[model samples]
Target: MVTPVRVVIALCLFVPFVAMLWVGSYAKTDPAFIGIPFFYWYQMAWVLISTALTMIAYQLWRRDQRGRSSRKGGVAE
Candidate 1:
């Protein structure tokens, strides 16, 4: 049941978790951005990035579901 599209969707969902959970990668106060410390700015940036990635994963999931439904002769996109 695994497809390339599903793999891509999994990647889209996994990246944000890996990025945020790996705190050492962003646990710094240097590289401040317009007064925002790296620690804070990095998290804020990931918030937006995570939102986008989640949206993409959701869309891909919908597409995958529709494909499966159609293959089963059910309602599809």
Candidate 2:
């Protein structure tokens, strides 16, 4: 019983993994930020991005769980 909300949650969780693992995409120094190399800055940026994504996924999961429980006539925990 896959739902659009669930798919969005999955994407939120998966995007960071793909972005970090795809090193070739950020493995360079041409785009420096405040003297920090692209490789370094990119990884740091992803850290923040990953945290945001995780938070979003967590919220969506909680919302989905609440919806499921309510539909079953159970109180959300």
Candidate 3:
């Protein structure tokens, strides 16, 4: 059970990073965002989103850990 939770957390952390790389690698050249290129802006936006997702994952991981501990003690209510 805990192993699955850990794996999910790892995937959540990694998938966004891969997505960022993919977006960066295939972005166009023109249509700059306020002078910044599409390649640059897209990566920057993903960086912010990734930070948010990481924070959310961390919170969920902490909650899962707490639940596991409480369940072990039969006090999870």
Candidate that would win on TM-score: 2
Q: Rank the candidates by TM-score, best first.
A: 2, 1, 3
Once superposed on the true structure, which residue ranges of model 3 sit more than 4 Å away at CA? 2-8, 23-25, 74-77
lDDT of 3 at 21: 62
Backbone clashes per model, in order? 0, 0, 0
lDDT of every model, 2 decimals: 0.93, 0.94, 0.79
Global local distance difference test of model 3: 0.79
lDDT of 2 by residue, 1-77 (tens): 89999999999999999999998999999788999999999999999999999999999999999999989999877
Off by over 4 Å in 1: 75-77
Q: Show the lowest summed lDDT stretch of 10 residues, model 3.
A: 20-29
lDDT of 3 at 71: 74
Q: Against the correct fold, how does model 1 do in TM-score?
A: 0.91
Tell me how far the alpha carbon of residue 68 in candidate 1 is from the true structure, in angstroms, after superposition.
1.4
Which 10 consecutive positions of candidate 2 have the poorest summed lDDT?
Answer: 68-77
Every model's TM-score: 0.91, 0.94, 0.71
Best by lDDT: 2
What digit string (tens of lDDT, one per residue) describes model 3 on residues 1-77? 45877887887799787887686574786778899988788778888888887987898788887888787986433
For model 2, which pairs clash?
Answer: none
